[model samples]
Target: MRRIVRTLCSVIFILHGLSVGQVKTGADLLFEKYAHLVEGKRIGLVTNHSALLSNGKHLVDAISESRRARLVALFGPEHGVRGDAPAGKKIIDARDEKTGVPVYSLYGQINKPTPEMLKDVDVLLFDILDVGVRFYTFESTMSLAMEAAAEMGIPYIVLDRPNPIRGTWVEGFIRLDSLRSFVGLYPIPVAHGLTMGELATMINNEGWLKNGVRADLKVVKMEGWKRTMWFDETGVRWVKPSPNIAGLATAVVYPGTCFFEGTNVSEGRGTDRPFETIGAPFVAGEQLARELQSYGLPGVVFEPIKFTPRDIPGAASNPKHKSIECGGVFVKVVDRNVYEPVRTGIAMLSALKKLYPNDFQWRNSIDRLSGTPMVRLRIDAGEKPENIVAAWKVELAGFGKLREKYLLY
Candidate 1:
């Protein structure tokens, strides 16, 4: 019995060593190195399903087990604390099962942490997953949280996460001032390839926080993370941060196909496979695929497919959900590096417009999603995809400079 126990201990040590030798995430770095900063302080955590440890433990659970950092309260983003809520729904406060701590809902009636929410905590910690798209609600939620933290004079600590989409590449146009919405409150391109920590640093440095407001802000940087490494390379498990985004493939195509949300076409909601499947009632998938093949978008293939949308159980029934059904195309990506998601998406939109002018309609709300009227307006005016993209090069270059100052790793 003694010999068997010793062998088990030895195996455990080896596994521990292997985990330590792997690349450290921002959460790992914070727990291992900078946890002292929050020692003895009343910390409030704002996080969701993505706030995970290297070994698949939630940060809340890890903090509860730690000797340092007394976690007082929890906060949920758009998807609620447990991340089970559908998009655009209100989250309510609840007790965490493992820690039994109070979890407040920031995405409810108010978008920011109120004074009441901050009263019991000295430091506000933010750790959530981000897909590296500008219009994702997580970015907006972070911005709002930063503002509230600054207003309350509490320190904001962001446990960084990889940008899933990688940081080395920059694409798309900078949002024009006229198109700002809750979806896009800042002037970033459709795909701003910075990690959450880098984004926090950039926003703080860029004067997004009011000049007079004061808050201590710090980012726990990730070790062994490179700008070019995609999420698959990080050896981190992918959790579905939102209902639609299920896997790395969904994330890779999201920057482009997400634009379909602003159109009459289906962005593949109400189906087993979302974002990966796209279509509309009027779309001739085969014809569209043939046309797209001629454009040579690089590293991606459009396969014509048909799908019937089903209701998500327990999801709120609305007019949009009354027996939802959509038809369109499936995007099969061969090489992420060679694929230009934004440009390909643009071409798809343009081709659909030409093929079915009457059936294809850009929802009036498109300006808010794309961050400008240009994408829809240009397509409506019969401009080619290449020319429409060319118009934004100057603005994109300017935003690139601004994006550089805030990169943390």
Candidate 2:
């Protein structure tokens, strides 16, 4: 019996080893190739839990141990320096324990680093994990940091990480200039399908930087990463960068269902599986799932399920402040390659409207969330989801052409 048990354990270990051998992330590539770039230089790092060495040590600790980079100030984004602050909350400056370096909060009083913040550092390094969606807020924070670095004439380095949503496919509407917000500061689609480093390059060349703010920018490119590979393919461990984005499944459905945040519906924020589960007070889960299934969307399946919103970490959890119990279907994406997130989200909204005309109403704040009122307006006017999606094709194609110039493997 002991021999049989040992054999079973061995099989499990082997399976785990096989899974970890598949793909490498941008963070993995950076540490392997260019750990010496910041050696001896006082470095300021804008990163969080996603940045780590291959042996599972945080990059801050690893760099401190290395003879190369002199780890100085640690910068945090929306979730704070340690990635513990709730989304959109202000992050306070503190000290890191592993390295005892001062940690600065970029999500607080200043979205960009002041000249004071960069005073001690000779070089600025950025290495945050990004979801391939527009409204995630991390990209915006990165952009702001770049702008600050450019303004200060500091050498900026972006340690590349894989676009977990992959880099080959682009989707959603091209954000109009007037519609820009903290969620989307530039004219890009909802899912830009580029790495943080690639987006930084595009922003620099496109003249998004303030006039006279010239930055000596360098991107440490990833090794053995493909634009088509998904996060699961990348053998690296999945760390939850933000609270709601629990795993790869959540990231897969996020680009589509995240729009629900601008509405009265729950995007599963109060539950254990946010983004992967979504519902509204008026939704009939089984019926809605059936209708969605009839559309035959590729790479996905709809499971009609019911969930009551409960307060969870990284999400707003007050019952009195929150709306009624959500009752929508859960989207199980069977295939990522053929699944279109933006279209699926729009279809879901449309279906809700048709299914319960009296109860379904677009929240006025949706315009801010979508970067424009057009999506909300069209849905209200009884426009077909396909037609609404079709209207953005020309603009999306134009963005795609422009995006081609900045892509780096």
Locate the minimum summed-lDDT window of 10 residues in model 2. Answer: 314-323
* lDDT string, candidate 2, 1-409, tens digits: 9999999999999987665455554545556766566767998889998887567878778777767778878888988766776666788888997688998888878778888988998889888889888888888888888888888878888888778888977888877788777788888888899999999999888887767365788898877677887877767667877877878889988988988877667778777777777777778898999888887777888898788776665554452125456677888888888999988998888888778888775665577566677899899899989998898787887898899999898
Task: Give the alpha carbon lDDT tens digit for every residue of 256-359 in model 1.
Answer: 88888888887777776777788876677788788888888889998988776666853322313236455578999999988888887888889889888998
TM-score, per-candidate, Cα-based = 0.91, 0.91
Q: Among these predicted structures, which one has the highest lDDT?
A: 1
The whole-model C-alpha lDDT of candidate 1 against the native structure comes to: 0.81
The superposed Cα distance between candidate 1 and the true structure at residue 2, in angstroms, equals 33
Taken over the whole model, the C-alpha lDDT of each candidate is: 0.81, 0.80
TM-score of 2: 0.91
